[model samples]
Target: MSIAQLTVVGGGLVGAAIAYGAARSGISVRVLDQGDAAFRASRGNFGLVWVSSKGNKMPRYARWSREAVTIWPELHKELLELTGVDTGLHQPGGFWLGFSEQDVEARADLLKRINCEVGGEIPFKMMEPSELKQFLPGLGSAVVGGSFCALDGHANPLMLLRALHAGLKEKGAETISGVDVTEIRRDPDTTQFQIIGRDGQRWKSDRLVLAAGLGNANLAPQVGLEVPITTTRGQILITERLKPFLDFPTNKVRQTREGSVQIGSTSEDVGFNDGTTTDKIEWLARRAVATFPALANARLVRAWGALRPLTADGYPVYQGSTSCPGAFVATCHSGVTLAAIHAFVLAPWMAGLTCAPPDIECFLGDRFRDPNASFSHDH
Candidate 1:
């Protein structure tokens, strides 16, 4: 087999970010993207460059997400420099709104456990309806309370994707859209990898990075790795451009730089369904209006549904295979939040260099207890 250079098999945020970073290092890369048919989490995203209330069950993941937040500004500048695309990156702050006292208390307790490890950032004052006015003027009085964290922000996710794609090419990465990778064959003894496309075009690379979003689980077993991932459908509602009244991003709504409000608050366990529903869109619009009355008259410009590439444990999975020496897999829920870390940190590690800045073993997909734990093998 010819000595492989570098071949990445996905073009969504996760794969595109890592591939762009690695290619920026001057390695040759081929990104086989499925294009429109692929469940594009990037399109349906709320576009919050957020970092609060993540990794509740695992401190390691919390620290990782926070690290990415700090690294994001530099990345935005780099992307703009490379592609002349300003990503509209903003970091005034973010909010988690609540309609009742119990909701505030519950989220507070959850943050309490996760924030202790990150230190000081986890706990914030419960935003009484009055205090909420300081952060969110014109907030509907019906809003019971909220939580504010300084460690959060928002950006145009599509612009981020556009910047990443252009920057990757500027860095000399080959991004092939609509090409589906059918197989990843690895020589058990030689550690050689050949990534075959559905059209029978084969790519031989000494190193392979599988960041294929929900498509990783099926690809991992061919290289003796595990990617325990499942799909959770999330929907979003976008309101017509209006004067911005909301300053910070909430889980249910965020105002984009273009002055359009983005509303999202639905998570369903439905499998492989990526179509938005009228009922859900209406429900989210109503919730957003309840929190911020300014949104009541705002006409909905768009709505969408897409699968969140989620793990059962709700933490990222980063691992290399014992059976396939040169192949590695990386997947996570917070792709936008963690794009910088994937570029600066995980890219280097996947390049086979030793000495990571922190302990990353916890993210290995193999942590699942079941020896035969099944995932989306056919996906």
Candidate 2:
């Protein structure tokens, strides 16, 4: 089996960013995309490059997210220059609104704990309604308080995905779309991986990366990796383009560059059913209106659901197969927020250009190997 220098079996944000980064590093790359039918969380993304309440239990992940957002602009700029595509990144900070004092207090505690555990790098402010209103004048009366994180922000997720794919093409990487990868086999003697499609199409490469989102659960085992990946359907709502009212992105609602307000996301453990429900849509709309009274008059134009590729503890899985050298698996729900780190840091290591990040051990997939260990997926 012979193909490019690196074969990435997933063409969404995670795969594309890594592929683009490897290509920019002068390695020939090929991306096998599962196409439109796949559970593409990239397309249904809420577009928040957020880091406020992440890693509540693990400090390493919090710091990882902090580092990712800091370097996001570099990826954005490089992609723009290389592919002439704008990702619409905004880092003016973001908010997490709450309608009850209980929830607000818990949020404050979580943020404070995360900040302390991460060595005070994840700065946040617990704000009263008045202070929040200063930044968000459209704040509704139902909102009692919120937290603000300077490192939090948002971007056009679709644009970011587009820019990465465009940059992949510009960097001379091959992207094979509309194909389902059915199997992956690693030849121990040759140290090569053969990727087989559903239709028997096959390609091979010296290095293989399985960043296939939820699909990683099955594919990882093929290459001697154990990734415990679970899917949670997140239903989101989008309103028609409105006047620029939202100056900053919030957990519940955010106005896009195109003026449509993105109201999201209910984390339902419904097992791979990526379909929106009227009840969830109404809940989102009501909450958005409660967050900003101005949204009461907004007309909802679209609603959809996407499955988030989460680990047992909702952190991430970046593991290289010791049993099968040159094979790796990368999976995380924070694709948009972590795109920069994936491109600039993880890609180089996966392509054998540099050593793995020092903290890579913290995100290994085997952490969940204990069958008796109980886990949570709050991310």
Candidate 3:
């Protein structure tokens, strides 16, 4: 099975990772990106490579996320060697701070259930305020308790994107920017795919991948796949550079490598309006200060909003088009957490270098075909 040419739509974390992986496998790959005009979630991410407390009801997703973080070191090293860019990965475990005992108890129960479901593969510790204070010395009195997962960590998302793009170039993958793909058609004589752009440019390839984030909702149906993905606006705030204080990333707050604290994010169901609001910003700031009182005096540097491409259940959608062979669609909210898997696992399978990842069937879009199917985006 020779995949002569492959094209990935979108240049965000998901597409870039797939393109890099395919190119690294010695397949000719091209990436068509809509450029800055696109709602690039890769730009505005929380940068967490987290695992615990994810996939509360789905064990398959839990396992997939665990595998992604486990192989992150390999991906990090390979990208550094190939592109000379360090991604600033730190996996010293992370915290999920809670204000009230009820919140902490609920979190603990959820983690316990997830661990039981995954057969104890996910390890976590439920810590009280005293125990948590040892790990995070600056915790405010309002912090009752929290959960810690050794598998949880974070990185510089911008650097990771840069490294992936750099690795793509180093591996000889071609990237076409400013291309708004409008149509996808199959050639009757050759069964090849022709991706048509709005600017009258067309590219043909043996395989086509729709990893276009929010764009997948529109593009997937064109190739016989349905991705019921919606957009949620999440606003993030950045504090000025301070002395190194935080050692691990949390669900609500994290200090970057340059010593700036990143506080974020409210999940709002605003349709395509990725704009920040004062209420959300103030809420995030107050929460961050409560998490670490030191942040109360810190200066806020910036704030912005980005849309998360999420399915009804907040799990990923990875499936090949049965109606149109050689066509695939991939969309997920955890783009930062799953970049490694996208590159190393999904990429090879898509490129025909290996079989699909074990248990990938759980992520098929057909799961949503059931009229009685219920879903949640809590993750």
Candidate 4:
């Protein structure tokens, strides 16, 4: 196999961010994308750069998310300068509405624990309905209370994806689209990886990164790693363009730059069925209306479902293959929130220009190997 410098399989947010980062580091890079037919979670995301309730069980993830949001401004600036695209990042802060006192208390506790675990880096407040109303004038009566986090915000996800691909091209990185990677094999003598496409085309690289989202499940094994990934469908509803009302993003809803109220997302365990259901859609609509009564008059314009690439424990899996050197796997559900770290930190480490991020050892795939290890995707 004739080795190229680097090959990244997958071209969605996760893959594009890493590829863009590597290309910016002056490495020869190529991205193999499975095309539009692939289940792209990036397209259906709520576009939140959130940090409030990220890592309740694991403080490392909370810190990682905090760092990602911290560096997001730099990433946003670089992408705009390189590609002439604006990612629509707004970081005034965000709110998580609670329907009842119990919900409010639980949210406060979760935020308190996360902030404490992360050394009080995440500043938050438990706001009463009256206090929240000052920030959110249109808040409905059903919104009993909520938690406010200064680090949370949102961006235009589609534009972010476009800027990443454009940045990759500007850096002279090659992108092969509409190609289904069927196999990954390494030559014993040269130790170079040959990635085989479904059409029999082949590409070789000295370093290979498996950032194929859910597809990592099959591809990781060939590279001597394991990624226990599952898919959960998230349904989203978009209303007709209205007067800008939301100044910040929420866990369930946000008003976009174009004035459309985006309401979403039920975490359903239906396997690979990335299709919206009437029941879920109605539930989301009611929930949104309950959160903001002004939404009752908004007309729904679009609805969609996207699969989230989730690990068993709802944390990221960043592992470099011990058996297959130069092979790495990166998977996470918070692709949008963590895009900054993926591009700035993980990319440099993968290119061998920098050491791994601090505490990255906790995310290794080896954690799943323990027979007694319990897992939960509640996050």
**lDDT head-to-head 2 vs 4, winner:** 4
The CA-based lDDT of model 1 is what? 0.80
The parts of candidate 1 lying over 4 Å away from their true place are: 1-4, 121-123, 188-190, 371-379
Computed on alpha carbons, the lDDT of every model, listed in order, comes to 0.80, 0.90, 0.91, 0.91
What's the C-alpha lDDT at position 123 in model 2?
91
**Which 10 consecutive residues of model 2 have the lowest summed lDDT?**
1-10
TM-score of every candidate: 0.94, 0.98, 0.98, 0.98
- Candidate 4 residues lying further than 4 Å off, grouped into runs, are 1-4
43, model 3: CA deviation in Å?
A: 2.2
What lDDT tens digits, residue by residue, belong to model 2 across residues 1-379?
2234999999999999899889898899999999898899876788999999989878899989988999999999998898889999999999999999999999988888888888899999999999999999889999999999999899988899999999999888999998899899888788788899999999988999999998998999988898988888898899999989889999999999889999988888899899989899889999998999899999988899988888889989999999989999999889999999999999999998999998899999888888888888675
Model 2 residue runs over 4 Å out of place are 1-4
Question: What is candidate 1's CA lDDT for residue 53?
Answer: 79
Model 2, C-alpha of 344: deviation from truth (Å): 0.0
Question: Scored by Cα lDDT, where does model 2 land?
Answer: 0.90
lDDT of 3 by residue, 22-90 (tens): 999899999999999999896679999999888887899999999999999899999999889999899
